[model samples]
Target: MSYRHTLTAFILAAVITPGAHAQSFDPGSMKTPDGQPDISGTFTFRTLTPFQRPQALADKVALDTEEAAQFEASERIRLNRDLFDPESG
Candidate 1:
């Protein structure tokens, strides 16, 4: 209503208003100093569990102690089967 009230309201609005500053760039317009396209480095990624488990074991979430031991034993047997088999020509 009054000049002082209007000035105070303007100042309060300026202070309380949400403001952000960000930059936008065109990917095609970017270039390296050597006149080549800017590129990122290579990366390697790994995960502990397989994406899909066998259908027989679908109902299990995590391996129990005994189950883990059994799985490890089976894996070792498979891995060492050729080493133990001596019938090769």
Candidate 2:
């Protein structure tokens, strides 16, 4: 009788355990009571801006249009120089 009771309890636990798995929360479906989705929290903003204006800028706070164009042209030349090399015999 004791063995039968233990077997029954084991079977019951095995059947119920699958229903206790954790569920994921969907942020888009959540809302405040006043009907506006809550968004009053600290957020981070990131950018490609360099920590320091590059040395080529020479103490300039930001690049002017002409300076930016020159910088981009120089960078493209540096990157593509190898591609323009003549094929070796």
Number of the top TM-score candidate: 1
| Displacement of the residue 43 alpha carbon in candidate 1, Å | 13
Model 1: per-residue Cα lDDT over 1-89, one tens digit each: 69999999999878766442234556766678777997666754343343568676789888899988787666555656776544741
Model 2 residue 35 distance off true place after TM-score fit, in angstroms:
37
lDDT of 2 by residue, 13-71 (tens): 99877766435566765678777888777865343344566676766777779977787
Q: List the candidate 1 regions with Cα displacement exceeding 4 Å.
A: 1-52, 85-89
Candidate 1 residue 38 C-alpha distance from true site, Å: 17
Q: Going through the candidates in order, what is the number of backbone clashes in each?
A: 0, 0
RMSD of each candidate? 12.2, 14.6
lDDT of each: 0.67, 0.68
Error of 2 at 66 (Å): 0.9
For model 2 the TM-score comes to 0.33
What lDDT score is found at residue 4 in candidate 2? 100
